[model samples]
Target: MKRKIFAGLAIRELREARGLTQLDLARRIGVSPSYMSQIEANQRSLSGTVIIELARVLRVDVSAFSSDDGVRLAATLREVLGDPTFGGLDMTQQELKNAALHAPKMARALVDLHRIYRRVEERYRSLDDALRASDGTVGSHQSAFEEVRDYFHFIGNYVDPLDRAAESLADRIGARSEDSLSRLSHHLETIHGISVSRHSTADGGGFVSTLDRARRTLLLNDSLPQATLAFAVARHLATLTLSDEIDAVVQAASFRGSDASAVCAATLANYFAGSLLMPYQQFAEEARRMQHDIERLATQFGVSIEQVCHRLSTLQRPGNEGIPIYFLRVDRAGNITKRHSATRLQFARYGGACPIWNIHEAFETPDRFLVQVAEMPDGDQYLSVAHAITKGGGRFDAARLRYAIGFGCELAYANEFVYSDVIDTRKSSAAVKIGVSCRLCDRSDCRQRATPPFDRRVTVDPDQRNIVPYQLG
Candidate 1:
């Protein structure tokens, strides 16, 4: 069974652009006016013969009907619209489609403008009393990093061309062997004329992998688990093999500077590595079969739990999309370390995550999976699972940073995940009330409220004190 491709909006746009009426184009294409109307309105998918006739009569390439440009533009527009500063400004899907079809340049311009606005706002957000007193310019990379994050986020965190190319490379090199790391190393050394080496100890405490381009040697930290070592090698191989594909995405981003472009490039290379480790189609099937058990998927793919969870979030490749999920990582302090969403649940941009969320508790119980059915202020519910992950500090004296990784989807998708089997998501009393963050939350009765919301009035009582003395009005 093949999925149908409907280009009603594209057909209508092309016909109107060519100064042809629906009936006129229908007659020219040898189709009924009613049928043409249905096609133009996207009420019907065009057949092969109809597409050919449409191309011949319209005197335009058939690609006009199957342009990914419209899809990309719509994605950018959606990201631009999702800015918190543009809260309450809603646009319908039809309007977004029209904008992509008819005013792509304008749509891009809006995205660019929003990017600039966010950068300026970020500078202000980072400005402190000391910086202001000293008249020093704020030096924050949040804007640039957030731009790169937004680029991946709006694209649904999947780079199809790179992903497919990686899959092909994996197939060519026979990467499906039980000994994945050995096979991958052999492929790199034989096919790409690159030698793989490992560092006795973690280099500089921060660098995971480095490539000496002149020597053509890939150096990996020996301390990394086999999965991470293989991933590092895969990332380097992707840079070598898929440079053009990765560069194309970077070019399309129109990043503000070389630093931002470099970040985008690194992100894409990592995406390729993840996709290579877990080929999209096979991984999606296995995930569904395993009920999205991260540990099982990790063991099957010979990857880490974090790697499995991250790859699961990228299963949004159009027709092959898996269960839509949101992936979030936070430090013990509740600062969001990494966040991506394929669902409606969005993380806070400027502050700590909500205190009531189980991700916070994950820090207390390291390596133990915590499950919760949490309800947001808007009444949206999710089945969240979180566990703490510790990285680095192979030696006892070295610094060990602890972070919690959380991934979940809406209640509608609860049944599709393994963790939700033991929990009752349908019970209203079982749901834990949560919010985006303390400052952005409006839950007045929450005992865990840390601070007053930005838009709400606070009544401070001098004499009264309950769970909190301040009333959010």
Candidate 2:
């Protein structure tokens, strides 16, 4: 079916573009001139054998000729039929197709334009980042994973399993209170015999480390209220239930021999801690009631903003599922350190995101929120909404970093989110043109690019017009 579409179109385009008579292309492809004319008119269709023969002779994609897009292309081509000034045009559909065929640039330009326009109007997410992430290189994958880990570090310097756990506890108690952290700390030191302390003298970030081999005490240097409780809860879980699990993760990840074992152990410990708190079934329910509102849950449950954000990142639990989320913590410079994904999103690990994305824009707006129904390169679309989150720990003297968390999905799941209704889904299908990155993007007209991709050159300009010097060539 597709083959017939492209082949018929191809034959017509090639014959018409060069002003070729039926005899012209027939001799070229070794088919009878009459046969060529019939194919052009779609009175007969090209077989695979003929399809390849035409491509070999015409230098075009065989699939390009037989694609479903060809029918659309034909309809689009029909728009040109209304062109009264297309002089002396007694051309059949086959003749127009011949032009599309021989003039390869025209065929690609029209089809590419249609695809891009559909993306704009339709609102799709770009898959170029995902493709780049999947590049088969060891350094690339590790670099990405390290970026993920580092992103986690920047968020709170420790994953507070207590966020998920404490949220569940608050729901069970039928109350949401701001004093939950103090309540939690008292519950731990008094009820569970867990120890909590603050070492304000350290590098002044957050992370809970129990050097059972050396220091008998759990060391939490974040020295903040929520960090203290989170530290106590994580220490309790690791020292009590998850020690064996942590060992397993160490052995299983082959991290035991590497110095990164401690990091892996702590990371897995954080995961287990979050699992203990959220426990899948209970937290997933409240998450729905809270509408996945991070700050409200943090306030009600007495967890920190970063803690709620981190727990949200873990709703990826098996069996009792939850809304997919992507979480990240970045410095003001757009350096992302800890990022977690339960969605299809593949963010840039080493640098800032597309400036057009809402995360960066959130910084400018500060407390204001925004949503975008976005489309990507693979013909897939998603809705993205972001907000800026800060961590100065209720202390004015404390140093803080501004970060943004964006959680969204492929468009099919838009109805599942609160922000989806906040934005108009009925807008006209016009694409917001964006590239993966200038150095990695293939967009030719992008004025925002600072560099060009490796294989493509800067489309050099002889005349001054656009301020941006780089263009895809």
lDDT for each candidate structure: 0.80, 0.55
How many pairs of residues in model 2 come into backbone collision? 39
| Candidate 2 lDDT over residue span 1-473, tens digit each | 12344356556676577786778778888889788878876667677778777777666666446443343344334333323333324455566556554454586465445433433332324355445445533233343345336334323232334345434554553323455445545555564565555566435544444434334344454545664355355445554645665666456544212435666666666665554444455556766886666666666555566666677666643234466666766666777667665554545533565665667777777776667876554344677767787754534455675787666665666676666777766663733545334443456666666655434545667775576764555
Q: What is the lDDT of residue 331 in candidate 2?
A: 61
Distance from true location, Cα of 133 in model 2, Å: 30
Error of 1 at 235 (Å): 0.4
Off by over 4 Å in 2: 1-187, 190-192, 195-228, 428-435
TM-score, cand. 1 vs. native: 0.78
Candidate 1 residue 442 C-alpha distance from true site, Å = 3.0
**Residue 112 displacement (Å), model 2:** 35
| Model 2 TM | 0.57
Against the hidden true structure, what lDDT does model 2 obtain?
Answer: 0.55
Off-target runs (Cα >4 Å) in candidate 1 are: 1-118, 121-140, 176-178, 202-204, 461-463
Total clashing pairs for each candidate: 0, 39
